[model samples]
Target: MKHLCRKVVAGIGIMAMCASMAACGGDTAADGVDDGSEMTVEVFDSLANYQGEQKGWFAKLVKDKFNITLNIVAPNVAGGGSTLFDTRSAAGNLGDIIIMGSGNGQAEDVVKAGLVADISEYIDDTEYLKQYQSAIDELTATANQESGVWGIPTSVSSLAPTESSEGVEPTFGPFVRWDYYKAIGYPEVGTLEDLLPVLKQMQDAAREAEGTDDIYALSLFKDWDGEAMQNGYQFPAFYGYAEGIGYVLSNAAGDDYQSLIDEDGQYVRALKFFNKAYQMGLVDPESTTQNYDTMYSKYKEGKVLFSFWPWLGQAAYNTTDHKEAGQGFMMLDIDDMTIASKGAQPNGTSTFIAIGANAKNKERLVKFVDWLYSPEGIQASGSQTNGAAGLQGLTWDVDEDGQPYLTDFGVKAVSGESVTVPDEYGGGDYTTGASQLNVSTVLNKDIDPNTGVAYNYQMWDSELAKRDTALDVDWQEHMGGARTTMEYLESNDKLAVIPGATYSAPDEDSKISAVRGQVKTSVVNACWQAVFTSSDAEFDQVWADAVANIESLGYDEVYQVDLANSKEMTAARQEVKEQYESQSQE
Candidate 1:
């Protein structure tokens, strides 16, 4: 650790923080002597009012641990925006830590710039590390090799779920307005052929109601988590039908785990279906660039009939709307997950956060992280304590007669539009951080104290159901971070994670990524375009060309790497499976 620190300091080339900045890291761990001072930067991320009125619990924890004052940075970057990242990197005025909201595209850049430390050395030693074996395995597989350790893998237990909710039905289904579905004489959407007509019916309904012919049936956006919620879950659910069990299984029939772009298999079948959908107006034509805010507009404004949306807000909102219009709202699982056209699979947590090299005290930070995952940690970070924003003065402690009594405001909030929650929260006030630490419980609940609305109730409930129903699905999920490299691999987006384990960078990975950029997006898009045209000649030509480029773009070596790594991992997974089976037999 000491040698690595020295190397980092030397590699970073003695451009120590300015005297003023150096003054901030008071008593915090430093490479050199403790100058009896500490440094702090206004760290920022996705959370709103993230500072929690200056004395937030998170802040207090840091302050107590390092004795450094972290004057919480204001103007919290809204929805994982770029203001903080750009500001910090440009001015080199980065804080002691820039906790990225998720391992989106930023992680790649963070690794490449050598701006963070490789906290991997401490992973095996941390008490909580054992609980996060799978995550560590995945992190090791995807991380850049240059920094070796990159960021510390946050052992956030809840966010590290193995599978998501499936609802009452067991098929590849998500929560839709099942009440509305039943009322509408639920159509036969058991196949691609069925979905296309339903999309048409939706388009026609939109045309009749809104008089806009161009308004699409499905609205997909790629920002503000657009692509994820939009295509990531919804499309795959449907796409897997034609693609078959391969979509959910450990490997396609003839392919290895890393062979995502093996066009001869399930993916190609799925792509052809997607191509058909694209041509038949089921998918939004202008969907490639829309953001989340824009995507929700179509749903909220009633522009389309059937679309994928969060059952929680959508159900609550629709119910509220019906009350206003003399009707009620109801949501259902829509019998989709069961009517598998293609496959069934696992859905994990929302996002990933890795520790920054600049984290003032790395070991302490890891301890703090582990503490957060403890029952108490989750409760404190959760809505129970109203976030790490401020002090949590309210409680649901049981009162006389054994009734759980919340504060007066909590009682009054029952009749209000939303539940009223206390402004004061976090920092050892209500003391949820010291409570029960059930990671699974956290995944199953996202209760908002203020609104009294389980905003994530549907998401959680649906995910829970998914978990139960998928007990027999022949599927294994490959989980890791790959956003930036994905964009770089778009033409051939399937080849994004072909490398086994992680890439340390400047060696094989850099080489692979550069070549991938050339053959990714454009090549795949072109092939799909030709296929959609239904021109056999064009399709054949494009397919031939894509295959031809495999060697030229270094895909041959990439494919070989995929084979070697994928076979090993799959074999290991199978061995584990057999071992479990044998143990069960005993």
Candidate 2:
């Protein structure tokens, strides 16, 4: 855990230092610096799990390249609430590096309070960051009204702003255990309601085959819930809608918005779906009390038969051994469902990365941030999450034909196998040793210049040629020879790509904010209660009571404001889409 500070010196001094270090059998740093000054940069990351000094191969990489050490401070892992963030912000400094969401008035509040440094002055000095100038500009305009570059948006894409970023898989939609689904004879799921019977059959088959009474068709958690039951909110995405300002669900095509409590809206429909599942004993009874980690553990244990996102069930269940055995989660077609997907975000994603205004060694911090956007940095830092091949020389390398291919160790590591690293590369478990920053500077599906293919290792020709696992082959065969889920969805016109745009809702006044808080609490509680109701009568009564309770709390006034904001966001998205289309035509 030695932290080093970089120093700028004359070319001759740098040469002398390198010569002296060489004479002493020491190697010069990757960036050609040989300074002895030491420093540790504190990073406040909202998405990270590991806290304290970063370790293993990722630590070694950054230490050698920038001569610095990263000390992570993760509020999510520390206390499971915002206590750490509130205290740190009140103390006048969040951290040297801050990663947070751009929603909920957070980015604006930080900018107005001067908690984050304005990076406009240092951006031009970055070598690789210049390519994302447009993304930075869009974020500045939306968050600060173009006043200054307060923060850089994460996951900026190289694709056109109008194109979806979904490659082989999507972030939303239903995934079922393929083996269980096949056991039930691949019944047609014509609508959301039809899925209940299918899932029940799959669950029964699993229980009978495995001789376990612990299996459930659905497992959910409440820790990630905010304004509403997040699990219920996910259903709307299955039918081409996403949560808008507050209490409203907007279409992915940016054309319409509706109140979440609407009698016929997707949100209510989702609540009914969950209630039916509960009535059939298909839902995990502990869902209301469990956290994400607990629910995920169930998935890993093969006790869950359904998942709402590919990332969740797939990551938990799709081990190499499971796939070879024709067992894993696979996206299932819901005839009435139109999956909501996001297009390439030229304006960047909702997450923001910024430097604290009170941080020391500001110049070095800027250099470090800039490196995160570089190709090499993207490869190394994004390896675990973004599906990028890791650490060029060790995990992957360019072949004789100049195409990137994963090394044998890389294949094993990426496939979730236990592989020991050589001591020179910071030996440890590959997955555990990954960088814990939990943020992406560029989209993984974007093309990598060196390979003429996407940064996702799955998209590489070499990897694709060998990707025919038994589970994959079975799923493809059942889907009429479709190679991937995205392909099947697109061919069937079941995907709705939301055009990317940079927009943040205006800050709510004190009265509106208060009303929103009360209404949200009431709605979220009511929805969860309705799901666990003993009968359909109780479910109906719960909804009626929730509607009356929220109305009494001035829900209508807040709804109007959110509705207006939704319209404004839709208009902004349309404008961005038109601009991209015009540029392409020209």
Candidate 3:
């Protein structure tokens, strides 16, 4: 409800940049000073949903550590909520901080409109940010000519640690309920069809157990529709293509690109599979109407047996009861199912982070953001994920080997078994919650540069192994092969390619931006209609009609732009990868 943007004259901004050690305003601190002001920043990030109480543990932790309170804005698909940028632009009432979605040219658009501040000069003074100079360079090269570093890459592809050295385990692929599969004799599912009968059996068992006839074999949500039922985005991995819903380079040269709309394409096959599930009454009835929240709730209730992503399924059953009974969701190496992990791959763009041009707490907010990327910030925010090491002696403590090990109380806290008790546990909402600042950035390596101690994922696994002997094991004794779905895919060389990482020229963006809405609407409406067709003949007719409609709407023209962009992106990725490799060698 509060606006943090402060209107300042152009002369004042130029003067502030010219001054060496002066604070920008009375309230704003100099470059690295904790102003200790109680600023409520209206944060708009689409990727995260911060629903915690204002005085929750994580929120309080941030406030105490950074001297700022976060006023997280609710998510809105249409124009990013009530504080519309267009309206704010007119009224001069934009929020303090804004995070733009990656790859869609939102950053470029905002910068062109002269809304965000250019922090290029400030970034040079940041200790942690200096390491990402090359990444910043690449970003600037592709960004608007007028705006320099308007949005730093929250998800830095170039700054990611090498695969061997990285501790974060990428989660993507097919997941099934561990309890349900074991009950059904753990039948082999080498193909998509093989999953049907097993799911049917599982659904039937759920119905029988609960005395309810409303169980579903598979659940679906409609929010991800971005130019077709974006479920097609997840389908290509099943056929060995690593990329999701975009042009894939055909050869070693990255000169040629292919679209995913053929009659026999992965998208088509996926739709047909869903249709078959629907005809057999295995699909959730509310799929067309239900949102992600509803689907997730059902997942938590153990009503859905199959999950496309590991995160979705894992969240539902990752509790003390499920863990004690070994009944959580487990990923499987199904035949023909290729798992894809969108690891810290350098997309020339980022889910852009930019400070408002009129931000009152500009200096403090910038310092807070810079701290978020630093080792201290990353650890405090729980970027390590496997071990969210924060609040020493409560959530975790340093061991004799200088590694961070979760205390017994920390384990119970994370596992949702008991309250986390710190040495000085002053109570005000003692619930353990995730930090609101875990944005994508360069992950500082496992060994801390300052302390020369191992932390992050390396230490997390070590401590986990100490507690659970079978912790590292990804599969059950009944299942033979890679430990997790990601491992299986990596071993067999089956990872999906992310289209967003691909490059497109500035002109291409301007051209496609105008036509994207038209193309997406036509494709999604038609494809969804075809998916719900009753008979095989009707499905064929609908599919053909949809294809014809797309062609008539100039789909090929838009696709041509995508093809060129893919080729360019392919070459860009190669160049960036080589640069990183050369740096590592140096």
Candidate 4:
């Protein structure tokens, strides 16, 4: 209901340049006036079904320690939400610091608006920020562009790549519920056909048990679910085209030669599969209207046997308080939802952060930002995940009534003004909850992912590791939808080759989005019809025909653009990796 974009004008930005070939070294320190001037940082940090909130944490710390006053501007009080920040920037009424998400394709807009500083020049300045020369350089090079500095990478986490298990049968590879599958076990359930016979039997079992027949597999969110509505410009690498993080890149080369969707006929195959699932009655009937809570509930109630989700979705079940979710649900990756594993690798083009134009204190904001990247800062933010961190803004053991109990403000609601938390730490700009690690206080108490990892850090990493082993077809290479990728496709035709996509202003961006909004719904509708029917040739044709019309309408040109962008990505990643390897040499 509230938007934070307002008229954000000039403030300090960062710029780092190499001092000399010989690396002169000196750290920059801030000289605080100790004026204790209170700085108000209006942020977006709400946690609800509709609106996101605004917050200031380091601001709280600054307010608590220094003479500076930290005023948090909420949407209700300011008469403006986050989007108002953009509007105010045009009207020249922004705050000192702002929070921006990295995944959205508007970094260029923010940069052009001059709402953020050009910090690119100071990326290598050791005096202002220290201890991560290698990592810092990597961030800079990745954002390198002749056009602008745009945004810097924030948050930090890196883990050693675990050895890929080959001989071990991937736990997710196809399946039949062992209980009902024995009599007619098709022996396996991974490949497309390898799953059919068992699905038919399951359908029969459901019909026989209930007498009133009609069963389905894979659940769908009513209308459009999981961000399918967002990809109004270009379809994403996956099938349903959901947003947020996913495995999309091919490899270091980033060519996308290894595709989940066959370069030529990904849509056709996807449609066919939707039809196949429909005919088999493997999809859940409620999938079309189920929210996440509903779907998980169905799984628990035994309403449907199998469906697709992230590997640790079972963990979300969390049998008891303080107990892990998905602890009991066995992952069956085979027939439920799967795809070719030998596809492109998805890179970390995820959530990022930027300062607000209205931040009350520029110096404080910089200091705060630098602190977050520091080992101490990374440790602080990672703790605020999975309801473990104390109250949102202020986590405490003491309540207002002098009760020695937690006066919680809801974890996600408490904090605000996040810098982009790196994928290595936690996904996106999640700067709350409490560190996912439990440490011995001396070490800032955050998880050090290198050797002695913490619980959540290991949990996420373990989840990523199981990706190869679990193989939910829906999540494999491509599931379905045109979330962010559609937008990327429409605006940046060049990116189809890789490194760069042609740019468009926000107006053009909106028009393209409108076009995609219509197309995507058609896709979901086709899927709804196809999957509802028992697995059959007739149902499969309807699905295929739908894809054919979509392809005829615009997919060919769109896909060509993707090819070009894919090529460019290959070139860009190669250049960066070469530089990263050289810089990482210690």
Which numbered prediction scores highest in TM-score against the true structure? 2
Q: After TM-score superposition, what is the CA distance of residue 136 in candidate 1 from its true location, in Å? A: 7.6
List all candidate RMSDs to the true structure: 11.5, 8.7, 6.3, 12.4
lDDT of 1: 0.38
Residue 222 CA error for candidate 4 (Å)?
A: 4.6
Q: Candidate 4, 277: how far from true, in Å? A: 3.2
- Among all windows of 10 consecutive residues in model 4, the one with the lowest summed lDDT is 159-168
Error of 4 at 307 (Å): 4.1
| TM-score list, all predictions | 0.54, 0.88, 0.78, 0.57
Q: Give the better candidate number (2 or 4) by lDDT.
A: 2
Task: Quote the positional error of residue 389 for candidate 1 in Å.
Answer: 14
Superior by TM-score: candidate 3 or candidate 4: 3
Runs of candidate 4 exceeding 4 Å displacement? 1-34, 44-85, 101-105, 118-151, 155-192, 196-217, 222-270, 300-302, 318-327, 333-350, 383-451, 454-518, 533-535, 584-586
Q: Per-residue lDDT for 442-484 in model 1, tens only?
A: 2223333443322232222222233221211111111122111
**Which scores greater on TM-score, model 1 or model 2?**
2
Over 332-367, each residue of candidate 3 has an lDDT whose tens digit, in order, gives 556776444443444324555667665665666778
**Whole-model lDDT values for every prediction:** 0.38, 0.80, 0.58, 0.36
The segments of candidate 2 whose C-alpha lies over 4 angstroms from its true place after superposition are 1-36, 80-93, 102-115, 143-148, 358-361, 416-418
Score residue 496 of candidate 2 by CA lDDT.
Answer: 86
How do all the candidates rank in terms of TM-score, highest first?
A: 2, 3, 4, 1
Tell me the number of clashing residue pairs for each predicted model: 49, 0, 8, 138
